[model samples]
Each structure stands twice: as structure tokens, then as C-alpha cells.
Target: MRTAEEIRRVVRTAVEAAVWAPSVHNTQPWSFSITGDEVGIHADVDRRLQFQDPAGREMLISVGAAVFNLTLALATLGYDPLVHLLPDPDRPALLATVRLGGPVTPDEHTKMLHGQIERRRTHRGAFVDVMIPRNFADALSAEAQAEGVRLTPVRSESGKRVLAALTRAAQEVQAYDRAFSLEVLRWARPPGTTRGDGVPADAYPLRPDHTEPDFAQRDYSRDHLWGYDRLPSATRPSAPGLVAVMSTVGDTREEWLRAGEALQRVLLFASAHGVRAAFHTQALELYHLREFIRQEMLEGEYPQMIMRLGVTAEDAGTLRRPLSEVIEEDA
Candidate 1:
């Protein structure tokens, strides 16, 4: 094991990288507490969307993604991360506690993913015509399976259309509800604002290209006209390269965390292959829609994340609170 000071340094670095994990609407709904050589992950419930995510399930899943990022960071640094999910039941807010364990060498692929940890963003536009290599997709599916989750890629055009229509239904439901609209608007930042959290105006295109299935994106703008302008040079709206879902058998809290770990594994692997992912989780937010998808579509598996995968040349950025704001010291 590394010395206390060295462990502290590694933990700090890992938390720094873990902040890049995607959350619903860029809410960044998580915080970290550094206690000696270990770090405790907590859901920043203050950042949760009460109207849209009142149950805290999505918040937990997002924090689980952050935990996955922490493990990846530790692995790349040659320290096996020892993690305990939801360690204190009394303290429901505490998501996980991770610390340095035995030293283990990280492989080339892990290092590659670690490199893109910060640069990867949740894309909000259509993908170019480029095709995602099949081998990479298979490997990502394997990664998800390793975490007890299934990453199913929609193969048929009919399946793609069905998923797209479901997304449309969910988006329409969210759009008409004032409460849901307010929740989204709360996180969509206007241009020129320098907030360190929330979805930036430039995070997605102003006029997103409609793919064949016509997947609907979250209405972050809320019709107030707050977002980046579309570039004039852009011609056609690109295709939806890959439509996929992450699912598991159970709906327990632990399963949610596992789903999140699987999600990060898939996303980082996709990022390594230069593929960006756009999330259409509006369907998953509503209980009936989620239950319907699980029963009719997923064949008894619980849906965690619904996304479209593809390639893009965009240089979108992400933000997180400083360690000072998130990290709580034992003292």
C-alpha cells in the first residue's frame, strides 16, 4: 500500500477525474469528502432536481457514475480501488467510500480511457455519418456485462423508430408540464455566464440535426432562447449512429450503482474509440414509461440509461466544483 500522503494525493487526483462523469442535465449531483487516505462520495442532494428526480434514484445513479470514474482513475494510477457502496445505511446521503488497496498495473486501454476522462462530454447533437466499429461495441458490451448490466444496441430500423418515438413521448410529456420545464430550465445556463456547474449554452447545438429515428433531446432551453447558435457552415443533420440502452435485472440501489459502473465503462470505452454519446433519458424518468419499456421492450430488465452513440468533432466542455467545495476533511 502507498503511504498516507501518497494515498491522499492519489485520492485527490482520482476525485478530480471522477467529476467528469455525466449527470442528468449536467446537474453534477455529487460531492466528495476526503478523510485521511480514503474518499467518501456523497450525493449533493442540494443539486438534485426535485420535480424531475424526486425519488433520488437518478441522483444515486449519477453518483454511481462518479464512483466508477474514481475506480478508473485509481486503476490507471496502479492502485486497486477498495470500494464499499452505500456503506452507512443510516446516512443515506453517503453514496460510497473508496480507498487505495493493493497495487495493480493498469493496461494500455485503461490508460487510454484515463487520458480522455476530462475531455469526454455528453453530446447533445446528431452524429456524423461515420460508423462505430463493431469490435469496439462488442468490447463495450462485454464491459457492461462484467458489471452485471446489459448494453443492448438497437440493430433493426424498426427498433430504432420505436425507441425514438418513446423518447418523443417522454419529451412531449416533460415539455407540457410546467414543473418539469422549470426543473430543466434551472440547469440550463445562458451564454457568457461563468458558472462552474450546470449545462452550458454551448454544450449542445442550437438546431440539432434530426436523425432518422428522430430522437428527441431534453428541452434545456425551455423556449426562453438560451443556448448557443447553430453554425452556418453545417449542412445536413447527421444520422443516429447507435441507439442503445443499459439495463439490469433488479431495481435495488446496488443495482443502480452497478448500472452506473457499467455506464462509465461503456462511455469511457466509447470515448477511447472517438465515439460520443447523447442521452435521451426522458423516457426513463417517468415511472410508467420506464415500466412499459422494461416489460414490453427490455424483457424484464430494468432500464438505466437510454442513449444514442456516434462520432462528432465538437469541442464541448464540462465543469465541476473545486475539491475545496466537495471535499470534507476529518478535522
Candidate 2:
């Protein structure tokens, strides 16, 4: 059994790991509270994108990813995590409370995943041409299944093209909308920014690195000349990578949380193998477009995330809020 000091240290380490989980626009819209043996994960509603994520589904999903990281951290420390999701109906913001249970040795795979919590990054540009390992898609599907989510790779050329077209359409629509543009601007950090949250100016390429079939990226740079100026080798047009959609049977808040957990799990496993993911969630942000994809592509399952996975030569650094900003410890 662990003493109080050890448990406190574990909780602090877990929160530190949890903050590294990716969030939409790098919002990092979650907070942690420690009370005795339990750690609370709460959604910071103020950080939610009101225009883009009015329903707060994406916010819940982001927090759920943090939950996965926290639990994985605890497991790595040899403690079973008892996670209570949406524990109280009256307290919607309290997403989860995790209590340290009996101790057990973490498996090799769990250790591998836990090792990647801080290293995994959300890739934002085209991937190199090298093919991913064979049967890797199967492994990713299993990871999602373990979290009650489906990871479907768009294998057919036609399917990839269709999804790409929809993404482009949505990106164009959002870029032209004043409210959507403003929301994205609010989270797009300027160069040399001291703020820890938001998509950094250097995270994306200065000029759009267009892939074949061309899935449009969010205009984080907007009207300014912001973004990384990569070398010629990195600027060359590259493959769109393996396109996949994460989906669930239901579209409830619970399902969104599951999708987020599954997302982080898949991301960590992929990162462990030197793979990275670039997200194209524009289509999913639009109601009509999301419904269309759900009906036409996903066959009724709600698509929570659209992503392309492959190996990348570049590692664009990300920023996160310091532990002091997000953690609250009981007196």
C-alpha cells in the first residue's frame, strides 16, 4: 500500500501527463482537482468554442482524452484506476473522478503507451510517402474497440476522395463565415506568444502543403504570414496518408467521451510506432455535413473524429498550460 505522500505525488504526475493530451484548436479546455485519494477532471466551459462547438461534444471528447492519460499514468505507477464518468447528473462540468484502487503491475503495452503520453503530437501537415506497417490498421481498430469506439479506415480510393471533397467544402464554408473565422482566430496564437494554449504559429506550414485529393487545413495563419518555413524536402507534395474515421453507435455525451478516450489510445499507440496523425475535422463541425457523412460514409454511426495517420519527418512542438494553471489541490 502507498502512503499519502506517494499518492499525492502520483496524482500530481498524472495530471501533468493528462495535460499533454490533444484538444481541438489546442484549447486545453480542462482542469484537475485533487481531494484526498480522488482526482477530479472538469471541463472548463469558458474554454469551449461557442461558435464551433456549441453542443460541447468536442469539449467532452477533449476532457475524455485527458482522462485516458491520467488513468494510464496511474496504471504505470502500479495502481488500478477507478474512473467514474459523468458521476453526478447535477454536476455536468465534473466529467470524471478517478480513485486509485488496488495495485497491479502494468503490462508491457500499457507501459509503452504511458511512455508516449508527452511525446504524442497532433500532426498538421502532409505525411511522407512511406507506407505504414501491414496489419497496423487492425491493431488500431482493436485499440478503439477496447474503448467502445470503431476505427474505420477509408481503404477505397473513392471513399478517400469523397471524404477529402467534403473536408474541402467544409473548410471553405467555415473560412468564409465570420463567426467561425473569429472563433478560429481566437485560438490561433501569434508568433512569439507567451500564452501556453492555442495553436502556435509555427505548428503549421506557411503555405498550405496540398496533398493529392487535397483535404483543406484550417486557416490558422488567416491573413498573416505565420507558420513554419520548412525546407524544400519537407515542402514537396506528399501523401494524404491513411484516412480513418472514429465513430460510435450513439451520439450521446457518453459516446463522445468514449470516442475521445479511444482517440488518445489510438494516437499513443501510433506514436509509439513513430506514426503521427493530422486531423481534418472541418466536415464534422458542420451539422448538415456531419449528418451527410454519417448517413453516406459511416452507415449511421456518428463520426467523432476524422484523421489521417502516417509517419512524418517533422515534429512540430506544442504548448500546454503549466500545472499551476490547471491543477487545484485540497488544503
Candidate 3:
């Protein structure tokens, strides 16, 4: 019920919100195209992490998160979003197309999530020793279920330790592998770099603090001490927090996209409650480790993301590509 120009403006604002969704290494591996009133989401294959994510699973997941943001943004603006996932047969890179439909009132919950889209960040180090509300896990699980994915909290002490040990082993193996190291270094920016994308040095601590069963972090500071020098209070060792796994019934590209949507929803909802998340995705990146988790830890669900969530005082800023770099408007 809107004019052409108004629809374009709505789509444009939606894309602005979409870009804020988190991506692996801040790769921002998705692009947007607006034709008429529809927004097209495409995966930028060139930006895919070839060595680390050869299957392009992570890339699809990133695009999916963007899709969720776009949907939420449009909904928050009172426009019903009609989504078509993987609509094109020959052009597989076209992940989704969202068409704006009838207007309605935005709900309080949708607005709450939309408000946190830009504020949400990926916590790279330890979190404060505080208990997350018991109801939070159930709420987050409901969010994922709505998107057709499962968010399982690793509750058992032994189970948490196993995931931590597997993460450690995977990190150690990847650290020594030249290809993996190079891939990580490629996306790791040194302090003051002009690149708008990639994980900046300041996003992590100069030295990682240990948890009881240590969860290995990705080495953004490979050789140089290129990280934030935190205050003593922030450097105190803390627990690994709540370990959780995001999984899907199948490992297809569509399922990966669903997992990404679930991930962003969980993240935004958690952020709304002042909770932060640190990823331990090393095991998910490795083939054998991922298979082991599927069979043993996840009860046959294909695990997509492994993360720990808790409260943190630190908010290391992240960067994203300018909208001009990622958006294409039809003439």
C-alpha cells in the first residue's frame, strides 16, 4: 500500500540494519541488491575463507544471519516480510529475496531485538562471574526453534570439559597448520589498519586468561602482541560460562542458513539482556571433530556453532564494510 520511493527507502533502511549481523572474522560475505521493492541477498564467494571454510557452510550461515536481520528490520518498520530462501536454481549464490508486504504494528519483542542489532558484539575473552538467568536458556532455545534449528546448552560438567578439550585440540592443530594459520592471519588486522572488514587487533586481549577447563581462542595475535591491554580487574580469570552448541538436523546449505538465522536471533536476544558470547568454533571447523560432535555430543544433529555465553564488562568494537561497498540498487 506504499509508493515506489517509500518502498525503496524501507528496503534501504532494512539493509542498513542487515549489515550489522555478525560474520566470521568480520568477512561480511554477503551483498544486497534492491530490484523494485525486493531486496536480494547474495553470497560474495570471493570473500569466502577458502582454507578454513572450503565447504562455504560458514559463508551461508553469515548470509542467513543477514537475512534474519533484514526480516526483523522490515518487521520492526511494520512491513510484513515475504521471504524466499535459495530461490534461484542456477544461481546458487542468491541466498534469499525479501519482499515488503502489508503494514502492521510492530510488537515490543521485535522492537527490542531490532534495537540491539547494532549494539550486539562478539566477546573474544573471559566474562564476569555472574549467573545468567535460568529462564534465559529456554527463551534462547525458543528463538532458535522458531527458525528451525536447535540451540543446546552443554550442561553436564563432563560434557562441557569434553567440548573444551576438543576445542583445545582443534586450536592446537590449526595453529600448527600453515594453511589455517595463513587464513586466520589474512582476516586478522593489525592495529590501525584501514581495512573496514576483518577482526581488528583491539577486539581481543593481549593475553588470554584461563578458565577451569580452558577454551582455546583463535590466535588473532599470531606473532605480534597486537591486542587490547585491559585493566587488572578485567584480566581476572573467569569461568568459561555457559557452553552451548547450535545444531541442525541436516548439514545442507539450507540448513546452514537456518543455523545462521538461529545464531543471530540468539545473539541479539542475549545482547538485549546484556549478555555476551565468545565463540569456540575450532572444533566445528575441523571435519573429524565436527563428525564426532554430531555422533556423540549432539545426538546426531549437525553442530554449526560452538559458543560460550555470559556477562562481560568489555565491549571491543568491531568493523563492517560501508553500505556503499555491499549494496547495489537497480536502475
Q: Sorted by lDDT, highest first, which candidate order results?
A: 2, 3, 1
Following a full C-alpha superposition, what root-mean-square deviation does model 3 have from the true structure? 1.1
Give per-model TM-scores. Answer: 0.95, 0.98, 0.98
Residues 118-197, model 2: lDDT tens digits: 89988888888978765998899999999999999989999999999999999899888999999999999999999999
- Indicate the residue-level lDDT of 39 in model 1: 88
Error of 3 at 18 (Å): 0.6
Question: In model 3, where do residues sit more than 4 Å from their true spots?
Answer: 233-235
In TM-score terms, candidate 1 sits at: 0.95
Report each candidate's C-alpha RMSD, comma-separated, in the order given.
Answer: 1.5, 1.0, 1.1
Query: lDDT per model, in order?
Result: 0.84, 0.92, 0.91
In terms of lDDT, which candidate is strongest? Answer: 2
Error of 1 at 158 (Å): 1.3
Query: Model 1, residue 270: what's the lDDT?
Result: 85
- Which TM-score value belongs to model 2? 0.98
TM-score of candidate 3 on Cα atoms, chains taken together? 0.98
Better of 1 and 3 by TM-score: 3
